[model samples]
Target chain A: MKLKQLEGLLGNLDQFSAPKIELEQYPTGPHIASRMLYTAENSFEDVSDKVVADFGCGCGTLGIAAALLGADHVIGFDVDADSLEIAYLNAEDLELDVNFVQSDIRNLQCRGKIIDTVVMNPPFGTRNKGVDMDFLSVALKVASQAVYSLHKTTTREYVKKTALREYNAKSAEVLCELRYDVPKLYKFHKKKEVDIAVDLWRFVPTPTVESDV
Target chain B: MRLLTHNMLSSTIKGVSNGFPLTIEAAKVVEKQVDMNSDFLKNIFSKIEWKPFVEAAKTLGFSELPEEDVQPSLLDSHEFLTKFHHALLEIHLEEGALVCPETGRKFPVNKGIPNMLLLEDEV
Candidate 1:
C-alpha cells in the first residue's frame, strides 16, 4: 500500500482513552508511524510477509501498519489491558487479524525465532530510567531479522553503544530524526503540546551460530 | 489469540523451567476465514512444535491436523497446507486460559486477546 493511504488508515484508529503516566502511555501519531513502517518495508524489506510483533503496542498502530503493508501475521504485545482492548478494536476496524498479548516486555518469553521483525514506540524512560533499554533488550532477543524503534535523539550514542555491546546487536544505525508532538495527556505537562526530537533506529541482532559439540 | 501467537508464548514466572508450549484450556474457540499463503505456511512449519500445536488444535475443536510426526515434505501437498493454515491462523481461542506447564499458572484469554501479564510476585 502507498504511504499516504497507510497513514490515512492509521489516523482513524482509536487512541488511549485515559493515558497512564506510569507506563508512559502516549499514542504513536500516524506521521511517524507511517514513516517508520514504510522505511522498514521499502528500504530494508523487513516487514512484508514477515512475522511482525509490536512491542508495547498502543492501540495497535504499528502492528496494524505492518498488516496493512502485507505482513503475513502480526502480534501486538502490551502490558496494559485497556491499551490492548483499543488495539484489538483498531485491528478489527481495519479488518486486520492482528494478535495481541498482554505482557510486560521484560518478562516476555518466546521459545524460537518466530518473530522476524519487531516495531515499537517504547517509553523513552523519562519516568523510569533505563526502561527504554529494557524494551530494546527484549526486542533484540525476540526479533530474528531486525528491530525498528524510536528513541530520544539525545541518547543516540548511548542507544547505539548499549545495543552493540550489551544487547548482542550486530549493527545499530539511526535512520532519521522526527519530531514527536506530545500533547498534554497528563497534568505534568505545562504546555499544550511538547515537540521532542526522536530518532528512528533499526538494529540487527547477531545471528545465533549453531555449534558442533 | 491464534495458535500462531500461542506457539511463541511461554511462562516466564520467576524460576520456572520447561514453561514452553503452554497447555490450552479452551472454553470458547472461534474461527475466521483467511486467505492461505502457502509460502508463509511452508516457512513457519519448521518453527512450530508439532505435538503442542496439534494438541492446541484439538482443544480448539480442530482435529484435522495429523497426530503423528509431520515431515517437511508435507508442504508439497496442498491438502496439508490447508489444514496447517487453518489451525495456525484461522482458529482463535476467544475465551480460554494458557496454563504454564511447570508452575500451573493460568493466563486468561479474553476477547481473543491473551493476558500474559504476570503478577508482581510472579515477576
Candidate 2:
C-alpha cells in the first residue's frame, strides 16, 4: 500500500478513550506509525508475508498496519483488556484478522522464534523506570528477524548501549527522529499539546542456538 | 486467539516451570478464512511444535494434521499446506480457556483474546 493510503486508514482507527497514566498510554499517531511500518516493509522487508507482532498494542494501530501491509499473521499483545477491546473493534472495522492476547509484555512466556518481526510503541518509562527497556528486552527475544520501536531521543545513547551490551543485540541503529505529539490526556500536562522528539530504532537480535528449537 | 498465537504462548505465572503447550478448553470455536501463502507456512513449519499443534487442532475439532512429526518436504504438498494453514491461522478460539500444564491454572479467553495476566501473588 502507498504510505499515504496506509496513513489514511490508520487515521480512522480508534485510540485510547481513557488514557492510563501508569501504563504511559499515548496513541501512536498515524504520521509516525505509517512511516515506521512503511520503512519496515519497504526498506527491510519485515512486514509482508512475515509473522509480525505488536507489543503493548494500544488499539491495534501498528498490528493493523502490518495486516494492511500483507503480513501473513499479526498478533497484538497488551496488558489492558479495555484497550484490547478497542483494538478488537478497530481490527473488525478494517476487516483484518489480527490475534490479540492480554498479557504484560515483561511476563510474556513466548517460546522459540515463532515471530519474524515485532513493531511496538512501548511506554517511554516515564511512569515506571526501565519499563521501556523491559519491553525491548522481550521483543528482542521473541522476534527472530528484527524489532522496530520508538524511544525518547534524549535516551539515545543509553538505549544503544543497553541494547547492544545488556540485551545482547547484534546491531542497534536509529532510523530517524520524529516528534511525538502528546496531547493533554492527563492533568499533569500543563500545555494543550507538547511535541517530544523520539527516535525510531531498529534492533537486530543475535542469532540464538535455541532458535526454533 | 489463533493457534499460531497459542503455539507461541506458555503459562507465565511465576514458579511455573515448563508451562508450555497449555491445554485448550474450547467452549466455542470459529473459523475465519484467510488467503493461503505456501511460503509463509513453509517458513513457520520448522518453528512449530507439531504434536501440540495437532493436539490443539483436534481439540478444536479439526483432526486432519498428521499426529506424528513430518518432514519439511511435506510442505510442498498442497493438501498438507491447506490443512496446516487452516489449523494454524483459520481456527479461532472465540471463547475458551488455556490451562497451564504445571499448575492447571486457567487463563480465560474472551472475545477471542486470551487473558494471560497473573495475579501479583502468582507473579
Candidate 3:
C-alpha cells in the first residue's frame, strides 16, 4: 500500500471506536505507532511465505501489516470484540484477507496447526503492569518463529533471557526504535513525548527435523 | 504463538516472581502461509515492542532486521517491508516444550500447540 493510502486511512481515525466487548480502550498514535509495524514488515520480508499469527492483535494492525507485506495468510487474535471489529474493517478497507478471532492471549489454544511466524504489539502494562509478559508467554506457546515489540528500558534483558529459555530463540537488536512522542491522551500534541522505545525481537525454534542421510 | 505472548508466560509453580521468557524445547516446527493487511499493521506500529521482537526473530534464525535507528521513511521501501514482514509473521513452532525460568517446569507443545498446564504441586 502506498503512503498516501495509509495517510488516508489514518485521517479517518475518528470513525474507529473500541468494540463494546473491549475491557479497556487505548489510542494508537499515527506516527510512532505505525513505525513498529513498518519495522515488523521489514523484519518479515524474506519469510513472507509462512503463515503468520498476530497475538494480542489490538485492531489487528501487526497482522494486517504482515498480510500487506506478503504473508500468504494472517490470523489475528485478541480479547476485545470492538478492536476485532475495527481490525476486520481495516482488513476489508485494505482489501486484504485476514482472520480475526476474539480470544485472550493467556489462555489461547491453537488446536494443532503450526504457523510459520507470529508478530504482535501486546500491552505495555503502563496502566496494567506485568501484562506484557503474558502476551510473550502465549507467543512462545504458538509460534515456531516469532518477532515481538517491547520497551527498551525495562524489558531488554528479560526479553533476551525469555527467548533463550523458551524457544531457544536468540536476540538481534534492531537499530531504529519507536519512541512514543507523547502521552496517549495528548498524543495529538506532537510536542509532548512519551519515549516508548521499541525493539523487534526474533524467535526461532530448535530444528528437530532430521535431514536425509 | 507470537513472541509477544511468549514474553509474558511463566511456570506459575507457587511463588516465582521472575517466571518469564519461558524456554522452548521445540521437537517439531513448521511454517504456513497467511494473508496480509497493511492498514491494520500501520495502525499498531507505534504500540509494538520492537526490541524483543527482533531478539525473538533472531532466535528463530531470522537475523535480517533493519537498524532500529533508521528513519521511518525507510519503512516505505518494499524491500525493507518484505523482510520485516517475513521475520515478524512467518516462522512457526509446530511442537515444543516450554521450561519456566525460575522453576524447571516443562510445558509440552503437541502438534504446534503448547500445553501450559501446571501440575498440582507446581500450581
Candidate 4:
C-alpha cells in the first residue's frame, strides 16, 4: 500500500476519549507516520517481515500502520489503558494483528525477541524535563537495528550527543522535520492549536564497517 | 499475554541483570484459534528463541512442540508449522506471573496484560 493511502487509513483510527497532557499524548499525525514508514521502507531495511515496535504508541497509529504495511509483527506500547483501549479497538476495526501493551516505557523490558526497529514520538520533556531521554534509552535497549523518534528541534544536540556517546550508537542523523500541532489539551496552552518545530531523528546501534566512499 | 508478546518481555526491576526469559507461572492459559499466516510465522521465526519458547510452552502444558534442534527444513513442514503455530500464537497466558530470573519480582499478568510497572522507588 502507498504511504498516502496508509495515512488516510491511520486517520480513521480511534482517538483518546480524553487525551492526557502529562504523557504528552498528542497522537502522531498520519503524515508523520507516513514519512517515518516511508523512510524505514526505502532507506532502512524495510519494515516488511521485521518485528517493529511503536514506543509510546498513543492510539496505535505507528504500530497499526506498520502491521497494515506488512510488518511481520507489530507491538504497540503505551502506559495509558484508555489509549490502549482505543488502540485495541482500532486494531480490531482495521482487522490488523497488533499486540497493545499497557505499561510505562521505563518499566517495560523485552527479552526472548529483539525488536528490529522502533518508531516513536516520545515526550519532548516540555512538562517534565529529561523524560524524553528515558524514552530514548528504552528504545535503544529494545532495538537491535534502528530507532526513529520525534523530538523538539532544540534538543537535537543533547539527543545526538547522548545517542553517540552514551549508547554507542554508530549512526545518528536528523531525518526530517514535521511541524507538530500541539492541541489545546492543557491549561497552560491559551490557543486551540499550537505549532512547534519537531525533528525526526534516526539512530542505529552498529556502524557499517565497509564504507563505499 | 500472547507468547509472541511474552517472547519480547523481560523483568526490569532494580538490580536485576539478566532478567530475560522471565519464567512463566501461568495460573490461567487461554487457547483461541487465530487464523494461521505461515508467512508471519516464518518471518517471526528467527526472533523466537528456541529453549525459552519450548520451556514456556511446556510450562503452560502444550507439549506438542518438539524438544530442540528445530531444523530449517522443519520450518517448511506443515506438521511442524502446526505445532509451531500452537506454541507461538494459539496458547498464551491469560492470567499469570512473570517471575524475574534474578530479583524474583513477580510481574502480574491480569486479563492477558502483564503489568510491567515499577514503583517510582524501583526506578
Q: How well does candidate 3 score on lDDT at residue B106?
A: 78
Ten-residue stretch with the least lDDT total in model 3 chain B? B39-48
Tell me the tens digit of each residue's lDDT in model 3 across A54-157: 87766766676666666666777766655666777777787766665455666554422245567766666665666677777656655655555555545777
Tell me the tens digit of each residue's lDDT in model 2 across A1-213.
899999999999999999899999999999999999999999999999999999999899999999999999999999999899999999999899999999999998677889889999999999899999999999998899999999999999999999999999999999999999998999999999999999999999988887532
lDDT of 1 at A69: 95
What are the clash counts of all predictions, listed in order?
A: 0, 0, 121, 0
Residue-wise C-alpha lDDT for candidate 4, range A117-180, written one tens digit per residue: 8888887888778888888887877777788899889888988999889877878899898898
Error of 2 at B54 (Å): 0.3
For model 2, how does the per-residue alpha-carbon lDDT over B8-112 read when each residue is reduced to its tens digit? 999877887788989999999999999999989988998998899999999999998988759998988899999999999999999989999999999999989
Find the candidate with the highest lDDT and give its number. 2
Evaluate fnat for each of the predicted models and list the values in order.
Answer: 0.80, 0.85, 0.00, 0.60
lDDT of 1 at A13: 90
Local accuracy of candidate 1 as per-residue lDDT tens digits, A1-213: 899999999899999999999999999999999999999999999988899999999889999999999999999999999999999999998889999999899998766788999999999999988889999998998788999999999999999999999999999999999999999999989999999999999999887653110
Alpha-carbon lDDT of model 2: 0.94
What's the TM-score of chain B for every model shown? 0.96, 0.98, 0.71, 0.94
lDDT of candidate 1 at residue A207, scale 0 to 100 = 74
DockQ, 0 to 1 scale, candidate 4? 0.47
User: Candidate 4, residues B46-96: lDDT per residue as tens digits?
Assistant: 767787888899999988888777867778899999889888877868788
Of candidate 2 chain A, the 10-residue stretch with the lowest lDDT total is: A204-213
DockQ-superior candidate, 2 or 3 = 2
Write one digit per residue (lDDT tens) for candidate 1, span B1-123.
Answer: 899998888888888877888999998999999999898899888888888899999989989998785899989999999999999999999998999999888989899888888888987
What is the Cα-based lDDT of residue A54 in candidate 2?
98
**Model 3 chain A — which ten-residue stretch has the worst lDDT?**
A15-24
